[model samples]
Target: MSGETPLPATDPRSSPTRRISIVHVRSGVHILPREMLGTSTFGVAMKLLKWLPTQVVDRFLLIMAKMMIGDTEKYGLKRPKVGPLELKNTTGKTPVLDVGALSLIRDERIKIVSEVESLTSDGARFVDGGEMAFHAVVFATGYKSNVPLWLKDAGGVLTAEGKPEEHPFPNGEKGIYFVGFSGKGLLGASVDAIKTALDVSARWTRLSETKDVVGL
Candidate 1:
């Protein structure tokens, strides 16, 4: 199993700039006991939490924040944060927020990165003295975003196959605007996008009013 062990954090389908298979262990997991969702382990905890119906995770987060070594609120954020759409820790294990950053816990097996090398789906090749595989390989590197999904603009059509719709998104028509493409956090992105849209709409409305005045 050592040789076939799953490669670390790099998503094979995500990157092509520099192919690397590093040994990565997950960095984040929440295992507070009072959690009702019971995300006691890892892996699926984050995913399952997304579908849960309570603020248990958030509560634990706040509690954990208080217990941490530094400025508690700054670790996650500082606000009177209360939201109905909550992630659940339905899994028996403590739900991990960022699976890519998940940490090792006693309950969960620590997955380490190993065999950081080029992926060679292609035929093996011989170097000056040794053999190397993979003429070219692709990797899937995960991304980070602070925003939630619903907040982000639907943008293109969401297809059944999860393929993005075929519409010129945020195209500058009579009224269209985009806030963030390479922005940070999923939630932030949505807020920014919406702000743009609103601003665009307001400008359009004002221009229309002026046009009506001239026509009158």
Candidate 2:
């Protein structure tokens, strides 16, 4: 989260390239109920409600949204066109509370920067007319599944569309398995990891026994 850069020998004020600037650009959308941020609460709620019909879940979410976030228009936020359950199911993501720009606006420590124009050999130049000399850059990005590409046959563990199959770690392959691959979110993923580990251990034990018997 932090980095150090060597300063130029000359005074920074006298040299144009001696200063460093850090810029962070992002989509301003923020979802809230700040207490729920960075927790698996939303995913657990979704799992518990999964048994209910989609319509029922949707209606429930709509009510909850109203109670949690009132008057979206007043806050310059738009009401979701679809239900939370629908969105979660479609995106394979559990809903998490987000309060977009509100957090940044309230925090005095964060200085928002304008769009980046380009990166020079020494540092980054902002479109608004300033440049910074940075020795390191930290980027926070989301994750993507690369398991399919790693498997001998991608379809062995994934569906035709690249989604994890119901039984993410399927049988019929020797010495090949998966762990921590679940569409059910973190809680489900942990359960899947444990179960898969147990299964794999048992399978290996049986294989070793069979090999000993064959040698006998």
Give the number of the best model, judged by lDDT.
2
Q: What value of lDDT does candidate 2 attain over all alpha carbons?
A: 0.51
Candidate 2 residue pairs that clash: 20-133, 21-132, 30-98, 30-99, 30-100, 31-98, 31-99, 32-98
- Candidate 1 C-alpha lDDT tens digits along 117-188: 334454222222332333342333343344334434544434433333344445543343444442233544
Please give, for residues 1-216, the per-residue lDDT of candidate 2 as tens digits. Answer: 111112121223333743323334333322434332345436544665768887686676556556665544343343446665565556544444645533433342233455557766866667789876555555544466665666555545567555566643645355555554554557567776777788878888999999999999
Instruction: List candidate 1 segments past 4 Å from native.
Output: 1-110, 119-138, 142-176
User: What is the lDDT, from 0 to 100, of the residue 114 in candidate 2?
Assistant: 53
Clashes of each: 36, 8
Residue 44 alpha-carbon offset, candidate 2, angstroms: 5.8
Measured with C-alpha atoms, the lDDT of residue 180 in candidate 2 is 49
Q: What RMSD does model 1 have?
A: 14.8
By TM-score, who's the top model here?
A: 2
Q: What's each prediction's TM-score? A: 0.34, 0.48
